[model samples]
Target: MRHFNHLLQRLRKIVAVALLSATTAALAGIAPAHADWLKAESERFIVYSDGNEGKLREFVQELEGFDRLLRLRMGLTVEEAPPRKLPIYLVGSRRGLLQVSPDLAENIAGFYMATDEDIFGIALRDQTVNTLKHEYAHHFMMQNFAYPYPGWFVEGFAEYYATVEIEKSRILVGKYNQNRAYWLQAASWMPMTELLSKRPLQTARNRDSYYPLAWLLTHWFVGDPDRQKLLSAYLRDVGEGGDPVEAMQRATGLSPTELSRTLRRYMRGPMPYQIMTLSFPQPPVTVTRLPRSANDLLLLNQRLKVGVPDDRRPATAEEVRRAAARHPDDPLALLALGHAELHFGDAAAAEAPLQRLLAMEPDHVEALQYLVRARMEAARDAESPEEAERLENEARALLHRAYRADDANYATLLLIAENRAGGAGSPNDNDVTVLEQAFTLAPQLGSARINLAQVLMFKDRNAEAIALLEPLVNDPHRPSSGAREMLLRAKGMSEAEADAEEAEILRQGEAEDEADGEEPPTGN
Candidate 1:
């Protein structure tokens, strides 16, 4: 119902073009003749998928930076043979997870902690850095030593190390993400014993609590002297194949059971908290006409936005409630309330309003989408495993409904494809089907096209992929840098040749682009 504001419109245009050019170029490139490694200097691995040169370079840099930071913080030495490399997939949309695991990707922006090997993906660039850091922690831990470390410690330590503090803001990466504000919020203390004993599947199901619990436990161990020493000892003992329970008893002079209780008490006690916020301000609200006879819905969406803005003071909540009551059946009102609750860190509070709206208007696509998100948020506060699992399932169902309602929603489709690709596969029939489906839906959605090309490349169908990208590379309207790089790659030209071509093209285009003073077409 919201109108497309200038900012959103601008972003959409930029992202669309950027994505198109990037994918087009990727598919245009031919396999290199040299045996030289393809990865950026910083990363231990290189990804050939999605043919987006700019993105690939960025990924390599970030991974390298993360590795450097970890080496400094944890006193790790990058091994010459860095175990097996993890293939990191960066998708342009959040809902693209659905194309992978119909249920798991519905609510989360990124995913890891899977049973199968070779499955990892991160969506949304802002979240990508942290997610990569967090997953890398897991990869490092698993590879460095055979420590049967408790889940709490494994995930907790990862959270502590993954945190990125910049200037006035601090972000909790994985297992425990800060509140929507990026501010630390108090959680119902979960017992350490409970954290350790829970299986990964259980943890996955009750991610709301488990995520934070991992963070809190890690925070305690790293910040507190006694706990920190004991954790170090625990890792050492576990690495030696000693009984961790006995090791805990010896190291801390507390039995595993006692230590667990102490951890529960520690978690229950308050720890230092910080507020986390985004670099970007909240997106502007725009009103658009509703389809068919949903004019009332348009008005409803506007009033809801009026009720809440970036600075969510108490007065706004009261105003929101008042507006909601005025239009009980309004889909947008319920959607806004759901978003507000999510932002406020009260997932439980959001679920009812969103659910009610869905019940009243099953076809409300936005409402259905948010309803799924609301349930996932509520899952954090679920009192029991069954309840948490139920909420997660419910959320996934709602998301699937939204995705099915409009298969062409490129954002959702991208997430789905990325999620699926993260899991291990050899570009099987199913993967080919999904990738083709995604490519068909939005030819200009460069991310998907690139992903398809990557899959095709892996299948040794490089010629086919190159054909897909060649036209975009030659297109004068394509973003220059991305297109030139992709064109070179598709043609199997040497790097020097490619760079020369790119430089010449840039020299000719710089004047025009500067005169336009618009952002270079971005394929976000």
Candidate 2:
């Protein structure tokens, strides 16, 4: 059951990538290119290039520096590095890049694919560093923060970090992006209401202004002392499921019209460099070579291309299995095989390779997570109840271990809460606590909200359940039928009864106000 939840996250990523591919295809008017690729591994990234090792190595160094700068600026203090290495595909030429992603070739220098394990990117060699910095800014934020921020903020923050400049001994942050500044100067700005809305900008023209405007707003928020507290308050309110417009109004004491006017004036003014300089320690570069064979490259390419609309994952899985068989001790091959089997084949097929990978690298979070799922699946098919119970216990123990490994993981917390709620017995109080924490961590997660609502309904806390369900009832992406049903059940009342309930609550409030010697008269 936990495995299914894990798989859903992976599938969501895949679907997102597929949609991005489709959007890019529509915009570019070109198709995806298939080509032979080579792989280079760094401490933080796996560089897949069309045989551009030198430039790829430079790109990796730039990425490492940018990563360090981001950590310093964001105040993240991780004792160990991330468990998984990000994959960066460096296309040798513009033509090569177009073949891979026409949309990126047309509109942007590069793009990032937020897959399950790898934070993937594809770029031409000329603009590798710039493109990587932009995409990696997005990756860094998503990796560090559990809650979903406004789309505008996400892009704006990325644009803010994307202009990092690395020199001989110093790294520069918050450097003005000339390209974005130009865009802001040339284009008409979006209304603050539309710009700050949760919905993404659909048109390319809107997007052109969106990035620059986002940068400007984020810059002002961070740079202006007057707005810093407001920004913090806005983030907190939004994280707690408050309406974005209301949150903004409450925090800033300004309406949308006023904000737009102020923002326009700010943009028209002379923009400063706004640079923050810090000493950067040059780390020694280390490179690992991935298995470079026709089959190995093919399998890897397939794995990287899994989210594309025409992705042939079954063939990729077979290729991965063959690659793993050929290079039996290759951790990459094993990991790919395990993931492919888990997604495409049954858990039984996935378990052996994942187990082998785990043996080689115990702290591999993805492997640990997948293996837990595989074990649970095997337990479900166990010959006897005792065997099934033993496997279930083992799966639960692994889940706890996974949580211990990364308590900040919202998915792990959600999974624990889900498993606890779905147990044969009544849901536990601890489960409710975990669900609440998960909800706090990722307020945008509709499934988490729905599940928490279900738990609240079971506990007969209908008002709380109603509060949770109301926002999600209209969510198109998620199945909201259950939520709608629960809403109806929780707030079950005739029209007259609802009116009476409202009147009674208002009367009680008015009576209390009168008792405190406060005037309660109000106009409708």
Candidate 3:
């Protein structure tokens, strides 16, 4: 959760708030009231659904099957445990997806939010699953292969896997994503040069064809035996520092124009998919029905977790308050209410519920976290130095308590790193160690990585800083001027030169981002 997002905002007042990525969502806000709740807990997932119990159980098994399919193909053992149990909220139906994201973009069915230590997704259970799988594929890549894969293959690979068909005893993969069928035939396709070039094409509306086309190209390479080898070779060359377009030509011996024609012909023909017998059966699952009293708060908790746009926050926050009041003694309810309060920019208001939660469960990890955030924020606004220091000390103690309860929690480690290093002096070795540990726990978390890189740079460990910033700079989803600046420092550039380079990168990325409706990538 990267400090559950809300805590990070509090840190923004003290330190630089340079997140690695920020993608716009179709969702605007939420109004909460949930009943008929069921939870399906597996080793790698905790899914909440308000659908039929039998159907929900089957969905859980299918998801486990998909995880196995991914691992098996990637040369990993199927039985190994995942890093953490991902929480998924499979809302009831298509109407439910829209319920969460009323202004959802055309064809988008779901979304996922990832922090360094945790990730969660919201989608409609009994509806189109292509986008759900697509989002999970992105998560899988970020967790395992956070490599500097070319921008096209990043989307292409996920698109290729998005249509996976999970069955009881087997799985089907590489199927053409029918979700894009409408666009493939009717939408305006991008130029061959635009498709093949490493630079992102600058057009938001025209990007509609991007998904289907990327899927087609990936499918083409995967279906042909020789082309598959060529694709692997293309990846190898890119990994070894070849230009993506040039590497494509070197590996396949085809011009972009010729390749585009070949793809157009290929698109008109039947698609290809591979069927494999499942070597891994479904994992065990525990199902639980949430208490009736906790119903409304349950959904409210999920809505807050996903977030609400500022324009809609007040309304959603009020709903959260009302829901918690209905269950004053409920710790989970208090936690959600506290989260809503923090996000609504009323840290003081968050205290009551959080205090209630702590009084009941003194060691409640999340409650301790909310209190830390609230107190620090209060300190930030204190009337005098004495009050500020007192509040800060109290916040620090709560942070330590949170660590003792779950030391491995990335959020706690991150909070510890911030508290230790936020002052005038440079961070000591303990601070560096804590930041490094947080990075290890959530390599995909942008802030922790950036914080650790800064510490290393401060210590003149430029090589370590460079290695850490490389993937971040190369990740398309994570366009950070801070990362580029750090990379420049790590590479021994002058301060003036780094600043100049960062400005140039931002100028370029902003243009592409505006046109393509995506978070800009780190630029050279």
Overall local distance difference test of candidate 1: 0.51
Off by over 4 Å in 1: 1-42, 47-56, 72-75, 79-83, 113-120, 165-177, 180-187, 197-208, 224-227, 237-249, 253-524
Best by lDDT: 3
- Across 248-316, the per-residue lDDT of candidate 2 in tens digits comes to 889988776666566767777765554555555545555544443433543353343434333555765
Between candidates 1 and 2, the one scoring higher on lDDT is 2
Q: TM-scores of the models, in the given order?
A: 0.37, 0.59, 0.79
- Best first by lDDT, ranked: 3, 2, 1
The per-residue C-alpha lDDT of model 1 at residue 165 equals 43
**Per-residue C-alpha lDDT of model 3 across residues 179-297, encoded as one tens digit per residue:** 67677777665544445444344332346666677778889998777888899899888766576766877988876656666777888888778887764666799998775545676
Worst 10 residues of 1 by lDDT: 280-289
Q: Which digits, one per residue and each the tens of the lDDT, describe model 1 over residues 316-388?
A: 4454566566656556567766655655436567778877877887766666655655576567678999998
Which parts of model 2 have CA positions greater than 4 angstroms off? 1-61, 71-109, 114-126, 142-149, 169-172, 175-188, 198-208, 223-255, 293-311, 318-331, 345-372, 378-421, 425-524
Which is the leading candidate under TM-score? 3
lDDT, candidate 3, equals 0.72
RMSD of each: 27.6, 17.3, 15.8
TM-score of 3: 0.79
lDDT against the true structure, each candidate: 0.51, 0.65, 0.72
Ranking by TM-score: 3, 2, 1
Clashes of 2: 1
